[model samples]
Target: MTKVTAQLSVSLDGFYAGPRHDGDGDWMASAESHGFFRVTRWVTEAMSWRERQGFAGGRQDVNSEIVAESFDAAGAYVMGRRMADGGEVPWGDEPPFRAPVFVVTHRPRERLVRQGGTSFTYVTDGVESAVAQARAAAGGKDVAVAGGGSLVRQVLRAGLLDELELHVVPVVLGTGMRLFDADLGLDEFEGIELTPTRVVPDPQVTHLRYTVHDRTPLTLDDRGAGTEKA
Candidate 1:
C-alpha cells in the first residue's frame, strides 16, 4: 500500500519559520513569520537536490543526502495556497518537484504547466479532495505533502498522513509559524502515535522519520525518546 508522506523542517523551538516584522515594527501573530528559508538553511545550503533543481552551489554532503531522499521516488505532491504563494519567493520556471502537484486553494484556476515535467493543478474543494487527486496521480507511489504548517496540520488532524519526515534544525526562532500549533490540538492528553523508522544525523541538522498511526495519549518525550540515536 502506498503511504501518504510529508516532509518539513522545524527549529529547535518548534517553529517552521522565523519571526516577522510589521510595517510599524510591531509584532504580528505567530503565523506572520518572515519565511522558512532562514529556518531551513541547513538543508537548502548543502543540498544536492537543490543543485539538481538548477540552484547554483550547495554542499553535496550528509545534508544533501538527507534532502535527496525526499525527491527520490515520490509520485505526486500537495501543498497549501500559502505555500504556493509568491509572497516569499517564486519557485521559478521549473520547480524541484518534477511530478504532478495539487495546490489547495479556495480560488479556482486552470491547470498550470511548467518546465521539467511539473504541472500545477489548482484544487478548490479541500485537503481531502487534493489528497485524493494526488493519490490518483501517484499510481502506487507515495503522496508527498510539501507543507507550510497549516496544511500539514489539517492532513495530520484528519488522519490522512501515513509518514512524517522532520528535519530539526539547531537554530531557534523565538516567534514564528509553529509546526505544532495549538489550533490543531487533540483532546486533552490525546497523543499522535509515531514509531521511529529512521534517523539521519548531520552536523547542521537531524533528520527523523516516523510511521504515523492512530491517535492516543502520549507525551512528546515518550514519542521521541529514542529517535535521536543516529
Candidate 2:
C-alpha cells in the first residue's frame, strides 16, 4: 500500500496561484512580491534534476531540502492538466520514474513521450479511475497528487490523501485558485504540524509538513475514561 501525498506551495493568504494565470503566470506572480519569487524559484529548483529531463527551474535552499525529502519517495505521480507543462515533471521518458504517470483531463489524448524517462497518460474516467491507475503504476512506493485545485479537491473529498506538505509563499494576491476548494468537510484525520521553514528575500515563505491519521472514535467508560476491553 502506497501513501498518497499532496505537496503544494500556497501564499500567506492560502492561495496556490495569484491573479490571472494566463501563460504569464510565473512572471506576474513572481513580481507580486519578493516572497513569491523566492517560493517560486524554490519550488522550481526543488524539482530540478541533473539529468535536465525533469522540471529544471531555479534552485532555492528551502525548496531543495523539502523536495529532496519527498521527490524520491514516490514511484509515480498523478497530476492535473494545468501542471502538465514539460518542466514540472522529474522524468517522463528514464531514471526518475520509468513508470506510468496518470493525468486527469477532460479532453482525450494519446500518451506523451518526453525527453526524460517519463510518459503522460491522459485519464478521463474521473479521480477514482485515475487513482486506481496511479496505484497500479506506483507498485508500492506512493502516489503524488500534483494540483490544479479540482483534482486535489476530488482526492480530498474521496478521503484518499494520506499526507500533505504545503509551502506558504507569504504573499496575498487578493484573488486566484485555492488549495482547499472542496464542497464538503469532515475531520478525517489528526494532523501533526511538522517544522516550519522560512524562505529568502522577504523571509515570509513557510513550509509545513503533516501526517494523515484515520481512526475510529474511541469509546469512553462510565467513569469518563477510556474503556479497557479487548
Number of the predicted model whose TM-score against the real structure is largest: 1
What overall lDDT goes with each candidate model? 0.81, 0.65
Stretches of candidate 2 exceeding 4 Å from the true structure: 22-39, 45-62, 85-99, 185-204, 213-230
TM for candidate 1 is 0.85
Writing each residue's lDDT as its tens digit, candidate 2 over 1-230 gives 69888888787677666543455455534533343344455555553433234445555555565666666777778888766753344333453545567888898999876554467899988888888888888879889887766678778767777777777776666666667654535444532223333333435456666665553445545983566676
Query: How many Å off is the CA of 172 in candidate 2?
Result: 2.7
Q: Which is the leading candidate under lDDT?
A: 1
lDDT of candidate 1 over 1-230, digit per residue (tens): 67899989888888887654436452333335444665678766865766866778888888887777777768899988867764224577888788899999999988988888778899999999999999999878889998878899999998999999899888777887788888666998898889999998887888899999998875666767768777
Segments in model 1 whose C-alpha atoms lie over 4 Å from true places: 20-35, 87-89, 217-230
- Model 1 Cα shift for residue 22 (angstroms): 7.7
What are the C-alpha RMSDs, in order, of all predicted structures? 6.4, 7.2
In order of appearance, the predictions have TM-scores of 0.85, 0.68
